[model samples]
Target: MNNEISDDNSDMIISDSDSNSEESIEDLNWIQTFLEKPGNQIFVEIHMQYLTDRFNLVGLNKYCSEKMSTMLKLMTDDIDFLRGEYSSMSSIEKRMLDKECAKLYGLIHARYILTYQGQYDMMTLYSENIFGKCPRSACTGTPLLPMGLYDVPEQDSFKLYCPCCEDVYRPAHITQGLELFSGFNGSVLSEYKRYQQAFDYPVEKHLTLRDSELPLGKNLDSEGDDLNIINQVLKFNPNIDGAYFGTTFPHFFLMQYPNVVSGEEKPKQRFIPAIYNFDLHYNSQILRYQELKRQQLEEKLSKEYDPKLIKTKSKKIFTSKTKMYT
Candidate 1:
């Protein structure tokens, strides 16, 4: 009888261990794949904690429907089924749910970036311009911060803000379906000065025609017309090389002369660039001042547009074929 009892106890212990192992494997099946990816292992604890409280997921429901909201909860609320039927669901269904889950996580991320921890995680990427560099030649490859025009999802996609130009531009690279809130503009921008100090990104001074008293439309038929115009406006010879300085000049001149640099200039459609068919409104006084200066320059240029110097088929000859904005 004593031997039989010991055998029964050992059998029970073995059976329990097997069950526990199976459960562990199931739990690992989904999250383990993500955790195995580079740079995600460190966030294991934090990600788990983010899903622990419902409060952290506020405002997520507005972006998803009833069914999707349920799926998001099932995926996040339960520690055991964190991946939410990824193995059992059909591929199409799994993809749809996965998309919603990802968006929900983006909403969470937007909120997270406002916090101390998320800011720390994003600081490296922000400083590195992993999102993209500013498209403007004047910005000089400055790192960009991702921001959304609207806080609501599906209303708009992400935009990149250049700290140097203090203007937002569409990302140079296509981001597919990634949507985020404008939380970065609020929190990240508020802390940007501190970030610059920490990263040793010295504030750079860029020359602008706005502050200069330049002869805008003088001597159109003169030798070295481009250099003469630039020199008079910039007040210093910026070395009219076919590189950075060359690219920078046309942006200011493009407004006055549509094909100033021909193939190099972005199509002169609008003064303020648009993002995904949405017109971007500028609140920056500096941009306003620059636009005023550009208008003044155009007025002067218009007075000197000799029919011999500048050929025009129509009054508005410039039209954009591409959607890219600088």
Candidate 2:
């Protein structure tokens, strides 16, 4: 087994004369030029050996046709991997090889972003709002993350994930359509930690409840109903942290004020919404409220209507209709 592995590695090494060949030199020039591109500099540190390995490129052959015979050779300029006569190929043929080479790089990029360094780089981009920001007013322009709809290449385009709304949206940037897509076989990568970090901005400017508005020691007679309503909404995600309440359950505040209070009075720190949190639109909120009331009324009426009585009445109506038809 060791002997076989050594032979394979030795075969992958190109002779000095082969390295100086026209095709080999051209491959070298292409690689150098590609790495120098502004958008491709991130891949410079990622070695060609890993990128061209058969194990890492299991399903990428489907994207490349037979015209580009030696994919490994095109990428690494290694003579041992060469099978085709790239030196004799026409200009159009060389262009096809370049395109295939780029596709391979994209496949490698999908793998790269899953690495620690890649994630760090992507996190930096996330902070800079390079991917683009959520357009929903509730999200307050929180930076979006690129996520593949399907792990398979060319299966689906990428979507923008909003940590604030905890939802996905079609990206606004046209060029971003060809962006990051996962090549991982199983589950897609999780950005839960990223979401937590990106969503920590203060939201006091958007939502603030004065001590007077809080139901803690306020007039129980007037604020009692309001407290009950708040408690009911809170029940939707009982285990949710106060800071992320709006992410789980959307709401909005018409008025805003700083929660800070002066010397003798300590600020009553209630659970204020996060800046990168979802706030339902006012009109939609109204519709939802009416829908909830309608559901409650139906539930109340349902208890009075016996299922057995309804079934009996349906059977009698069926019998009358059948007799008339006969």
Candidate 3:
């Protein structure tokens, strides 16, 4: 089965490359350039929406919080161990301790993903407070020109840069924190500079398969096509990165798999929307938005509306007053 799967994947890649090769270079170039744009607002909006999507936001927050807690626990364990071993350590062992400390710093530097219902909105607020606008300025003379969507650091709320002018800026509080963390030592600053260089790189793009080619089920039709299942497996398998599949004779046959339930029936691959749509993070965001809206509406009505106005008729009261005056 493994041999068959490998052959199928190889064939698929070849077929995709051959088919996609005919695609216009101009279109590809435009896409690449658009992605390259600093502070590409559209991409930022899309990312914000994806982060704050009803199902993904909650899941992401929970996942991040749990990871943070786990990391803290591990750090505590490491510190305890280090304290026990510190006094008797030789020079080589002390060097190992330095390596351990560096590892800890790296772990701390790992990007933290925070999901919020109003992530896009929050980004705007942060931009307004720090850089004056969320959109990158097109003016070459403007300091904001260099600041793009990618310039925004994950987890850090205060640090920002102008992509156009290559100017770095941070909120006062954030600067204070950075000062405390660095203790005027150049090591943290050097690490941050390296991180910025890495963070500026383009996001990796993955090959997306169409619905018809997605393999998610265990059923085949009369003609016997297992291409969908093969494709789905390939998509989920992170190991297949930078690999291509070919579409030749024996390679096509690699997609055909025997049905386990009833040997006589070939199972067709079915698309599963549930797998992709089941983002816990997004669902939590939707719930949070609903709650927020509800609260806002309630507050508005309570403060702005008069209950007495509903009970009394202005026209009838005016008529009564007129009669008394007459």
Estimate the TM-score of every prediction. 0.40, 0.41, 0.18
Q: Which of the two, 1 or 3, has more lDDT?
A: 1
Q: Which scores greater on TM-score, model 1 or model 3?
A: 1
Q: List the residue pairs that clash in candidate 1.
A: none
Please give the TM-score that candidate 2 achieves against the real structure. Answer: 0.41
Query: Taking the tens digit of each residue's C-alpha lDDT, what string does model 3 give over 1-326?
Result: 22122433322221222222234433322223322322221122224234223443232223232333333322333444333444355655443333332222222222111223223333442333322221223322221211212211121222234333334443111111121223333442343343234334232222122323447752223222333222222222211211011112111122231121132222222222345567466666776676688679867776556666644657678889999999
How do the residues 1-326 of candidate 1 rate in per-residue lDDT, one tens digit apiece? 21121322221111111112234433543333322222121121236566546788765677665364455544444554444444456655554554455445445656655555555555555444444566666554655556655555544434555555657665424231111222233442333343334333221211121223236653322424333322222221111111101112213223333332343232323355568866556644556677788679877787667674455433334433232332
* Top candidate, metric lDDT: 2
Worst 10 residues of 2 by lDDT: 248-257
Encode model 2's per-residue lDDT on 1-326: one tens digit a residue.
Answer: 21121322211211112222344443464465444332232232345556656676676667556423475676676654443476677666665566566555555656655555555555555555545666666555655556654444444434556655557765433122111222222221122122223433121211131223466666423443433322221111111111111111111110111121122232222233334576546755776676688679767777648797789888999999999999
Candidate 2 residues lying further than 4 Å off, grouped into runs, are: 1-45, 66-69, 77-84, 173-326
Query: Which clashing pairs does model 2 show?
Result: none
Candidate no. 1 TM-score: 0.40
